[model samples]
Target: MASSESSLFSMAGDSYSKYEIRRRNPNPTAAALLVIDMQRHFASIAAPILPALRSTVALCRAAGIPVLFTRHRHRSPADYAMLGEWWSGDLILDGTPAAELLPDIGRDPGDRVVEKSTYSAFAGTGLEEALRGMGVEEVIVTGVMTNLCCETSAREAFVRGFRVFFSTDATATSNKDLHEATLKNMAYGFAYLVDCKRLEAALAPKI
Candidate 1:
């Protein structure tokens, strides 16, 4: 009878472990939408991710959530030191078409625009303060170069104690492998993983 009880306990523990493995995040209370690097140079290359981005933005707008757009802008090699070298002398100078947000997801006066030189949007930008001011507790992150800027921003958000929801279909990278790797890492432990469709549903108005 002791062996039988032990076997039942083991079976129950296995079931509980499996349930834990498949657990999902409780829905976020207040989420800010982060649109990262949807600029001219990267947008065309990130065409696959665009539709999802657009849908997510629209859903967020409809839900009255704040939307923050991040552009990767750098000074010219002659004007800036560290970043110009990092970009191999190419510049994403302010006011250049390359620094402009993609037209499909147009920015409203109410939406915030942030210029960042580094991969992390929160670094060297007012993004953190702005989010805090708006009372944003969760950030829905989406955009180009999944392995670089998007991943970095997501990590920074996590470190800052903001819940991160990374949309898998709304992010891209020049290398497919790198993109997949970032998504896998974020999904495993770094951030909550939701596809655009799921996000849209979450943002939908309840009947």
Candidate 2:
């Protein structure tokens, strides 16, 4: 599992290196970490990245950047949308254990948690408004299903005028191929790809 996780980071660095630009590091004062869908439903997928994700949360906290989480779930058919049709009853229902965020995640009582019914956290969730109210101009995205929620949120964030930094090691999916593909796509246009190590250096307090 560790090797697989390591390869994801390597591939992300290699694949996105060309697109990296100068001064893209997220400014702590203007940034927030968006931990997406780290719920029990995707526990296996989230397992490998848990340590890195936790580190990411801590790093952001230490840097004085706010950390928020998104939890995806459906209350009924009224909110299911196409996810229900596509997943064929595999949807995460509200109030179920699968819909709950993993307890081990580094979330604090004061941290804001957004609930969404779609892959895009912005969809009907008022996340953008919340971030705006917080004076956040940049977002660091991390969490489960790199090809789905993370990718969708990153693209939406880009179009919504937020500079996005996507975490490679702190996010995961069912397989490495899908994960790396999202990284390539994000690097090509939507966001700057960052791993935990990059985040550490970028967010570390200056001497």
Candidate 3:
């Protein structure tokens, strides 16, 4: 969990609810979509957001944007790190279907996949370097557990200097409250909170 002390990094009051988020057209060559931890373990919690994710991914693809997916896995006890302790020893092991990315999304041959072992994709992962190498300046985030992995990556991206755009309707958590809190926090501080429809429209190709 992130510290809530920073006002623009983790706002937790009624004022945050009044933020008016505006949609912007991200430069296709300078943006990437991060699909984080939408695996079997979070299937039920993530189901409702699949349509929105699918649409966002499709639009990104059509616009020539890179769609990067991160699958969280623990290959062995040695791979667990502090996450295991924090999760009370629970692990999403490798070679198990539980750690696999959901097949329903519109995955493409040009898409990239990065494997991670922690809550934040940038932790122990070369995600930042990879994004930098691709000339990516803005990042669009979507995936499971709005209050956890998704939120963590959004904050990480912001602090690392990437313009962060979080999909408000394309990410999910176990419950509504958890999802809403993270949305408010992100809107108040870390990223621009966008809906699927607004994003698709903003990314629409010019005729």
- Of 1 and 2, the candidate ranking higher by TM-score: 2
True-structure lDDT of candidate 1: 0.71
lDDT of 3 by residue, 1-116 (tens): 12212112122112333554643556777999999887876677667778778988888888888899998888888877787777754578889877777888877766788899
Model 2 agreement with the true structure over 1-207: per-residue lDDT tens digits: 111122232233234465454337889999999999988888777777888889999999999999999999889889877887887658888998888999989999988999999999998899999999999999999997788899999999999999999987788877667777887788888888788788899988899
The regions of model 1 sitting more than 4 angstroms off are: 1-29, 76-82
Candidate 1 residue lDDT tens string, 1-207: 001011110010111121121324324357888999887767455666666678878877788887899888765445455655666635567787777788877478777788888788999798988889888888988886677788999999999999888777777676555666776678676787776566677767779
Candidate achieving higher lDDT, 1 or 3? 3
Model 3: weakest 10-residue lDDT segment is 4-13
TM-score, every prediction: 0.81, 0.91, 0.87
**Best-fitting candidate, scored by TM-score:** 2
Candidate 2 has an lDDT of 0.84
| Candidate 1 residue-wise lDDT at 23 | 28
Model with the higher TM-score, candidate 2 or 3: 2
Candidate 3: regions farther than 4 A off: 1-23
C-alpha lDDT score of every prediction, in listed order? 0.71, 0.84, 0.78
- The alpha-carbon lDDT assigned to residue 136 of candidate 3 equals 96
Q: How are the candidates ranked when ordered by lDDT, highest leading?
A: 2, 3, 1
